[model samples]
Target chain A: MPQQKLESVEDLAAKAKALRRDVLLQVYKAQSGHPGGSLSWIDIGVALYYHEMAVFPEDPANPARDRFVLSKGHACPAQYALLADQGFFPKAWLETFRQYPTKLQGHAENHYTPGVEVTTGSLGQGLPQAVGIALGLKVQKAAQRVYCVIGDGESQEGVIWEAAMAAPHHKLDNLCVFHDLNGLQIDGDVKKVMNINPVPDKWRAFGWAVKEIDGHDFTQILEALAWARTVKGQPAMICARTVKGKGVSFMENQAGWHGVAPKTEDYEKALAELAD
Target chain B: MAGMETAGVGGKVGVVMDSLRDAYGDTLVELGNEGANIVVFDADLAGSTRTSKFAKAFPDRFFNMGAAEQGMVAAAAGASTTGVVPFVSTFAMFATGRAYEFVRQAVGVGHQNVKIVATHAGLTVGEDGGTHQCLEDLALMRMIPGMTVLSPADALETKQAIRAAYAHKGPVYVRLTRDKFPRIHAEDYRFQIGKAVMMRPGTDVLLVGCGLGTSICLAAADLLAAEGIEATVLHCPTIKLFDRETLLRLAKAHRAVVTCEEHQAHGGLGGVVAELLSEAHPMPLRRVGVQDQFGQSGKPEKLLEAYGVTPQAVAAAAKAAL
Candidate 1:
């Protein structure tokens, strides 16, 4: 049987809300995961993994399969939830988040996990690796694409721009960089700590086809990604405007949830809000 | 396998390039023909590091990562994650020193199968002087956990080393020199990662060497042989995976040992040998390498001679150790 393709924005929006709810429930159970960035990236992850990207659940290591790298690895709860939902692993394994000897480590490990394309936690480094994968795929004349999602806070790393400069120079149209412009990092708001505003312009200056979109809006993300797929001669960057801690009312735009999992009471309240 | 046989014979008859950097490019092209999985990466020194041949043969597999050594190493690590065995080439100084942190975390800690092929190591980089010549790369790379270190003696040895490195698992650093030297090893001489090659056997004194120093030690062995002073020459190529049994046997047979390398005496092959011998068998030892001082602009041979890294210096060090 053929896989059911995602058709409308409403279907994608409903899927994003369901995944966001799962993200909150998992983080609440783990009591030691990042809820904010995961919540903020729900729609984008859903659109990419469910709608836009072409992947095979049974043959995750298929040479022709598209690649996705989570450069900002702290937001792994969303990635884990999405992969689990996609049947990369058992959904029951999601209960063992951050547990000993589990394939799901605090950060993704490509060696152990099936779906993760690269193991990344260090900021600014994953983009180059993504570039390498895309370059390698191109060399093999494979039709697969590479997508790399990074944090706005992580844009401060010099290596990011170094990679960015090479992507367009090589004419890597198969590569797409998603800057999760969630405005907040560990210490405080990303703008106050170090301004990465003019984000799309920065990527544009580095030679990528730039697109800005409301991160939580499913229609905007789908359109941006579809347009990125059509672009040629250079890589594309989707500067996704997002709210840190997007789903729950109390956690929305809150910097404290950047790396913290909620308490039991906080988790229940967060789940209730996300469900509604 | 045909390329392997050619490389094996080529190194002995001097048909191969004189320098390891040159051989790196040639060998990469051969490896590319042998297998499609081998990819080459450079930090904008395609010609300097001599990987242009591979670039020409496999343009799509070749990535000139600009002047960003750190990003190159990290990306190489990432490529390795995808199951493509990537050989990242750059100057020894930049590949190890400038990108130490990234190599450490991404390759070493991540346990990626990325080969860091570095050229222009030690004083042999000549008039480019201290800035380009990396005398401390071995020390720095050997310190990293799970890093396999190889310093080949000549161009032939470099080909053998590259083949062996590909077969080996995990991260590897293959150190190459910029200057040309004599081909000492004969054809069919197999190179292994952990085992040291016993070049010449003697009982009185053991001369331990690596890289260009290995060839110098072999020459010194002939010099000492002419003088009726029996000397043993051991080519300790893989510094990280030093042969403990061979070293112990050499130490037991020869009362004193003389260590040679084109690097700082501190934390190099000498330091590694000293630490091993000091713990197991206390033997009188003398080191022949660059002292704790910077190199000056001069010819490569003059620099080696001035730094007391000559055949005569090895003979003198052997006498002194005795």
Candidate 2:
């Protein structure tokens, strides 16, 4: 197959809206899952898997394929939708979400699911693994890139910065990290719980190419990812400004929905709001 | 006699590095020479963890993750996902205690082919005190599903365990000590995963030990023999996939059993043995390990003695149980 070109910003935005609807439907069906962060990361997930990355679902174990790690794995609904849409597995697998022995687990498992890359749920660990993949590719002189998405609250972990420092020191140019700066976590506002302010400057100080963009904007997301590809000497960090629940009005910026699954009425409202 | 013959074939003789951490680095460097896809990683303690030697020789393959044990483990998992065998080195305390979640998710849960080689295990870390020393790593790591836990008795066994871990196609945690101890294994004794080594065979009592405690068990067996009491010493290196058949046979053959290790009695070697014996073949078992207590700053030998991990303790426990 010929190299797939980047989709138009409007098309990608529409896809994000569709993904949000799918996420709400799946979460509602599962009767258990985090919907707030899932909605927040919909656009970012679409941009990476559909536009920014060079992975082929036909061969998920392709050594040259770009790696995408869902560090904030509680938002697995976003990943499940992206994987199904990308043809990693059958779209019908999404319906099996949270069911025992199903590949579509509440948290991602690389063994059962294709294209999931690294198994993650424990917060603040995906970036380190991403760094390792980038480092490994560099060592092998392979052209594969590694993209990791983490939540703003997950940034409270010291290991993330530890990996941040090591990535640039090793000159992992194939690494691009996106922080879902949704400003909310399970407890409440991230600022009230543990301030991860100056996120961009902190990453820049650690020797990364820092970019702050509207995570909901496909055009900006595309431009930032394209810029990251051009940079050759350092890792890139994109502080993606996002709402906790971007598509659904009632759940937007709400901390209660961080880990709580939406009820039938809430799910209907969320799906209706996300319908394009 | 068979163990001696295997030791001869492997060239397992004489003063090997008493510390398993040093053996890990040296063996990794040796394994790198054999054209294997071996990679080394450390969480900023390359020198302290003794992986600096491998890092110095193969800088391209060695990654210093800088005080991030979780990241180191996760990266190792990622590397393994790509078919590269990665040996992740860190302090046992941090690797097992702090990065437990990462290891469980990325390596254990994923069943990735990553080797976690941890140093400063048990009370061997000494003066750095309880904060640095990890006397409960074996218990924590063993609890992870599909994790192969190997705590080699000495340097030679450590080298062999590293090779075995590399050969094994799954997640393996090789716990190592910081302090130097006597190299006990004969040079050619083959180290096999999940297989217990019957160091000395007798019928009166069975002394099962792992890691540093194995050496103490050997000493206790010798002491028992000197007192005209026949004792058997079994070296149980693999805590996860332990040799159940051999353990049951030894339990039936011996009059009583004594388990020893430099770890918390709660979930360490003793707990495992006790659980096994409770179901397989019940026996009067005495446990000689750290008894629900924390360690303190002192010389490693002093700490071992104070914690009742010495051969005298094992001998006493064996006698009482008998």
Candidate 3:
């Protein structure tokens, strides 16, 4: 299914808001999942799926189509929401988010779910796979680009840096990574737990074309992605400053909601706040 | 089997000694020449693992992920999703131990078509000592669901095993030794994944082995034969898709069984044979391996003898089992 092009920022923002609601609803119904990171990443996921990527949900395995990897795979509710919205699978499968025998696993599983390009749950695995995909495409001289979204907290994994160092070394300009810097992990603040501070500087020093942007803003997200495409001889890293719970007020900037399901009252309040 | 002029049982295992990693590298070059959509990844050990040969032949298809086994494995897993077969090589110590989680999550759980050819397994890594030797790789790789594990006995088997690993779908781990090994499996020998070859047929005892341990079993069988104790030597190159039917049949025929491997007696081929026999056909068995101890720096030959993984050890174990 071809995604309807949203040329206007209002249209893209509206789509992202709807996705946020879907993400919360999936989490509320399942009474599980990482809401904070999902909320933080939905806008970027929305921009990639709806605005930037050349994906056909009908031909999910199209070799020419661009690929996306949720390196911080716990934020899969956002990806599932976007994938379902884009008609990769029936929208109703969202209700079976973390349910047993459901394709929509608690973490993104490529084998089980359509449009999910890689299986990821254990942190620090997804990005290197993205690097691999990019490297393979480069080897084939394929034009298709690879995009990956990683969490700030997930950066603590040594493998993440290993990928960070490798992508630039291979000159994977076809690859782009968006760091979802929401400043919170499960325990508390990412800085307090394990600071991956100096994020953009690290990426730049590692030879990536680095950019910092407001992750929730459609204009900046789209512009940064376009900028990433123009980069050559190096991978692109966009350090996106975002709120932990982006659209919902009560959960915003709150670390406690990192992997918590919304109570019924919280769900009603979140839904009311997300109303058009 | 041509050129098998009076050697080990089945007229296989000639006197020529060759390196398993060299065979692996040559097979990779052969696959590349065959137009297989194959990519090779090595974690800064291309020179040691012999994947540098592939790197030289096909630079575009080769990636030297500098000293980063986890990233190399994950990248290989990622690359496999694009309908390209990626063969990742690293020392067994780093490949299966340091970057174990990556292998489990990216390759095993994802069920991606990535071949992990871990060279320099077991104490045969020699002078590197225990820190660089991995004796538990077989157990680690086999325990992962949907993983195919193989440990080829010699250079000839290593070449065929690499081909077999590529032909099969999903994740595969091929174990190789750093040291040179005697050539087993004759020129016409075909390697069927998950099957064991009966090197020597006997009725008194059953001898099971993989990798260098298989060579030791052959020698042990010769020793047993001289002692008027006939033993069946089953060279089990493929450990995961274990030839249980053959093992069970041989076990019923023999009075006792003994398993040998250049690894820990608790895991690897020894552990696998123990698990299989205890469940299907329980019998007196002896495991000749490292006996659950760390290896120290020594010559490969001395290490094998010191660890009690030699033909003498296997022969002794077989006698004890009897």
Candidate 4:
């Protein structure tokens, strides 16, 4: 019942910081995950899972629960951290992240994790799954909403547009996609590699109800989700503007950290900064 | 096809003829009547792929993914996670070629329970030309792990195979054709996955085939028998989980093996037979199919014949082996 109301911005931001710390720790242990992308999107994760979305971590597959798909699968450390906080799995699962045969892989896959709804690692796959699941839920006349997160760089794939076209055509208002508008990808800045400029306009053109927000702001994330739920006859797209490596001082705004993990000293420094 | 009659266990050979696509539609309606959680998807080719019948019958369950094969496939994979038997239909070219990575990642890697019923397979797609022919579909689908590949010869076989594929829980690729084919099985032909059916028995030459090529082998056997050749005909509808035991036994018992198919000679039925024989029983073999070449615009029967996949060609291939 407390989840129905947005938590204080200070509390949600603190939760986000802890999640960020967890993301850095897991990526540090794995030594091979996308820390930059994961860090950039943890705020949205914190907002959605902790303060928003009616989800049962114990019965993850419960038909009555809202669905969440991380289309930017490389950003799973953030999700893994948040899911741990929510008790979807033991907080101990984060300690075993990226260890072979463990539930936490380098990317989020539904088969491995109990709370994940779609197996996403390949970019541009998750939104379509969300659209399909939304369609299915709509057909069944269910009340559960579906939330999906895609990256700005992942927007380059053709399947994303295919799903963009489909969600609106089906009039799936139950679907709300958050584009983690972190300008940096594996190659560097998304604008330099290939600009996803005029992003909101494009979604609007595709017939989705588009909203622009600061992704790191829990207030805006909550507002967009709330507004999206009220919108009828179209899917909603929240273009969440964010920094690539958000929390840590050295890592923030650096594309080089997109995948490569921090060293022990660097991790200690990051943990100390968060401790401050 | 209201009361589309079915008959005995491989008893009535060549009694009726119908298109696999239409038979697929009729069978889907029958299955839809005694239904479970079966949902149909087509990439804007419902009229052509014959999934429109299912859409009409079970309007609530059918999802017409307009012209986007890649996303459609991934979405079907998504639907499967929610415990729905997803039957995704599209042209073979789009299903296997256009969305190979989507299928590979979603169905292959995700391990989703999706049945890909691709129509207009091989050279028989006619008029749509080489772009739509899709000769490499069987080869491509076979390469995927945990995928059941079935290329049924005629309407009856296609009908039964669709049901069997639905019942077997996992990913399946059933290639259907554009034109109706000569029915080699009785109306009540029950399809068993991974087991080749012995159409006819003989000792001089074993003529093995699948899809339209199975009937070609039957016709070749008739021609061979006329010349006192007495060729055994083996119909291998399931190409991936191929009947290795039956193939080994027959190859061991027979004089030589001649494989025929309406697909590429390298990776379709011919390749499967050759690979099986190469390992288990190394016997003399001759393959009757298209060489490494793409198909062209023409009539279905004419294209099959012109591409050197006729009854006479199969008979000649078997005779040459002898």
Candidate 5:
């Protein structure tokens, strides 16, 4: 782990605000992407990249560096923003997101993007891959940890439970996964579509060290990550309750914004709201 | 040539047979012992897939991912990112069918170094019937971009194919059978990934085969020889990384070609050869295998005969092509 001092909560919050602006801009430019999930996931993504995870943007494939997987791949604008900000690629490339021949693919393509550890556009795949990386680290007796963020909606995939069951069975203490529990999916309420309620109980039953936190709160997000490090002999799950589309006044808690790209007028209002 | 005659000669019953999965399991142990940073994952079919041998040998390196092939395949892709070669196994149906998208996205698109050695392929899966037997695995696996597809003929080729898959970087899907098969390659046979082995050197017709189909092809060659129609037998184990040069060269020498496999005729070796010949050397061609139909429960040999995947069927197809 890098011994660099953790960024202050306020600074991290400001950076997340910038990332939020970047996310909205990228989605607006692409004219196609999941802005709601991106907004919901940005805060947690910021907390991991800016403070908790030991990731080297210069040498992205450093064996000792921590790994991250965006399992809910539709929300890639947020991850793309973070990678760009971290110097994983040129910041200008964010404008090319979802465009033809752009390296910033609509979904996370690990081979195309430098810092992205795994390709995960498909729902319910990242957790198992994270588990595999953790198991591989354990086999090599390496200290590098693995981090993954999954959409609450993505939990409906049966492979999630399969990975969830396997991690604890293998005693994968080095894996830390976060659930972006934004309470909404593309098809309206997640509850109506598929109720994954009692989320903490589910993780506990699956043999993970579980924590519930306000996902938007930088302190809570950071604290949960710190707490995940203290866990031993089992993987950690941080279920973060968050509004569907956070920060923007009109978008928050709105299922309609789940995948629809904001129109120019809506984009202006959203940008104004996120402006420093 | 006489050695090739031993395969599928006096029926599949009395002949000593070798299990492809047995060779696969033993090869995994061999690879593990050679200090290869290799890991094995099985989705609750270790006993059948023969990954149990590796699991017993390297208890720590082996992982039984339960019945979750999707998770197993994805996890193997993840493990490969960390520089460990992960060999995943399950019955052919689940490995390619149950977990197709995972294999496509994680291993294929991501270009991860994961070996998917799927056992229990084709009509040879016998009593399990069509649902368990995967006749379209070759087609499914071949469609994946950058995926190396292999269908070894016998035990010796199975072992060498495993080693080749391990040595090769990127994703590879190997198709193996449930039943023990007669050996087609000589003891001195050295396997190469893209090179086809010439089992016999006749020129009346070209008989192509992979997996159990190779033995069938060799038997068809013998049957054809007795009737004054000398045929060439080409064993094509690697379906995707095919020996196009050798195939086209042999195609030039022979009057016609007959491709055989235990898979659906639409997209296994037959489809591959058709696609190749249509572009390169279009000649009188006949694909001898299961027609577009599901297999039924029966004795393995009986199933082969019923599905029109036998030597007689191949010989007839060869004669028809000629």
Candidate 6:
């Protein structure tokens, strides 16, 4: 597939909106999914899959291509749409999300889905897996890099810290982690549930080169990813401040929207709000 | 049968004892030397688990995921997706018990080619008491979807089992013990997945066993032989894909069956054999093992004795079954 000319932030913003609508549609169609977290990382996912990451639809498993693992797997709708729109699979499968015999599982399964690199729904696991792949890629002497996107709520898991320490300790410069700090989690605010505050200092103390950015801004997302690509000895952790439900008005910052699909009337209102 | 006369018995344990962990490490080195794709992960038990041998030989391929078994398992799953055979190792207690769901979801459900060489398994992980000992590792691992569980009886089988796991694609749990076990197989012995090794021939009772208990069963066969009761000792290395055909033939040929292991009587080799026999061939049988009890701090040999995983105990079970 020929690489498209670099899309401006306006173009990325449009793609992210489409991706958000797709996530809402997927969840509403399936009657179940994690919409809040999925909506949290749309622009970031777009920046990676669209412009920054060296990936192609024809060569999904490109040996030298960048690998992406959604460690916060419940937010798979963002990735599922990105892969489909990128032509890795079919866009029609979006409607089939969470339905039986669909490649779009409740959570992404690596073997079942074409573009998904690892199977994850169980949180706090994908970071370690990404570290392993980065280490493996480093051993292969490949220029390929790994981009791992996890959630702040997911950071509360102990193994994520284990992986946070491991990647930098192994000197995995080829790996970059994106922590979507979407404050809200199930049962209310993440700070009140299990505070993973001081997220940047935490990664820095664990030896990661930290970068903070507005997750909704594709330009900032791309800039951090570009900077992350150049760092040679230590892994990069880009902490992106994001909203729980960025596009939809009713769902934004509400823990109830974390896993619930919007009702029909609310869904129509969300679609109209995103039309702006 | 050919090496029977020279294969001395009577609780002597003089059949050229070798450490299973050592063979596992040596086999890993051989596997690593053959290709650059073999990546090894150890959860800070490099010395105890003997994965340190692989770590030292292939430093680039080795990952010491320090004292984090859950992280190690998930990382192994991640590495396997990139076409590298990831061999994750830790004590069985931590690997299977502590990091079970990670193994189940990441490796088993994900269908990753991760070889889990968990050492220091069963009651033989002595002096550390019940916390370190993992008698239920086999049972827990066998239940994982598409998991291949192999508990080799001795060093020779351990090496072969490691190679077998590497050749096969999917999640595997190759259980290894801490202390050395008496060699029950010849040096020329080859391992067959899901097949039992007929260590000794008998006609009265079939003494089915695995891990170190196979050697104990061999010794028990000798004890039963002296008392005019011939017992066939079948060493089942692979507990999950157990050799059902061989078990049925031997069970029918004998008067009764007696299953033995250095594990819980409810869910180890005894449970597997009993479940099989009751449906297929319901006859009088005895399950000899650590009768639903946890192990305590003691010598490995003494723990085995206290747990009743001995030739004398197996012989008594065989007699009672008969």
- Tell me, by DockQ, which candidate is best: 5
Score every model by TM-score.
0.89, 0.94, 0.97, 0.93, 0.97, 0.96
Compose the digit string of candidate 2's lDDT tens values, residues A1-276. 322434898888888888888888788888889999998988988888778788877888887788888988889899899888878888888878998758888887788888888888888768888887887777778888889999899999887887888889989899988999999998898999999898888998999999999999998999999999998899988999999988889888999988787888887777777767
Interface RMS for model 5: 0.6
lDDT of 6 at B294: 85
State model 1's lDDT. 0.83
Which prediction has more favorable lDDT, 1 or 3? 3
DockQ score of the complex predicted as candidate 6: 0.75
lDDT of each: 0.83, 0.85, 0.90, 0.85, 0.90, 0.87
Candidate 4's C-alpha runs over 4 A off are: A1-6, B1-15
The CA lDDT at B156 in model 6 is: 82
Higher-scoring candidate on lDDT, 2 or 6: 6
Candidate 5, pairs of clashing residues: none
Candidate 1, position A233, lDDT: 96
Whole-model alpha-carbon lDDT for candidate 6: 0.87
Q: Give stretches of model 6 more than 4 Å off.
A: A1-6, B1-13
Candidate 5 C-alpha error for residue B195, in Å? 0.5
lDDT of 1 by residue, A199-254 (tens): 88788888899999998888898889889999999999999999988878998888
Candidate 1, residues B1-322: lDDT per residue as tens digits? Answer: 1221211212244334366787878889988999848888899889988999999998878888899998888888877856789999999999999988778767876788999999888987888987887999999999998999998887788899998898888889999977776676788888899989899989888999998787778778877888888999999989998798999987899878989888987788998899999999998999889998777777777787778787888888888778
Ranking by lDDT: 3, 5, 6, 4, 2, 1
Q: Distance (Å) between predicted and true CA of A192, model 5?
A: 0.9
Two-chain DockQ for model 5: 0.86
- Between candidates 2 and 6, name the one with more favorable TM-score: 6
Clashing pairs in 6: none
Residue-level lDDT of model 4, residues B35-149, one tens digit each, is: 6678888899999989989889988888888999999998888778767788899999999999898788778877789999999898878788988899889899999999999
A7 Cα displacement, candidate 3 (Å): 1.9
DockQ of 1: 0.41
**What is the DockQ for all candidates, taken in turn?**
0.41, 0.72, 0.81, 0.54, 0.86, 0.75
Q: Which ten residues in a row have the lowest lDDT in candidate 4 chain B?
A: B1-10
Clash count, one per candidate: 0, 8, 0, 5, 0, 0
Clashes in model 3: which pairs? Answer: none
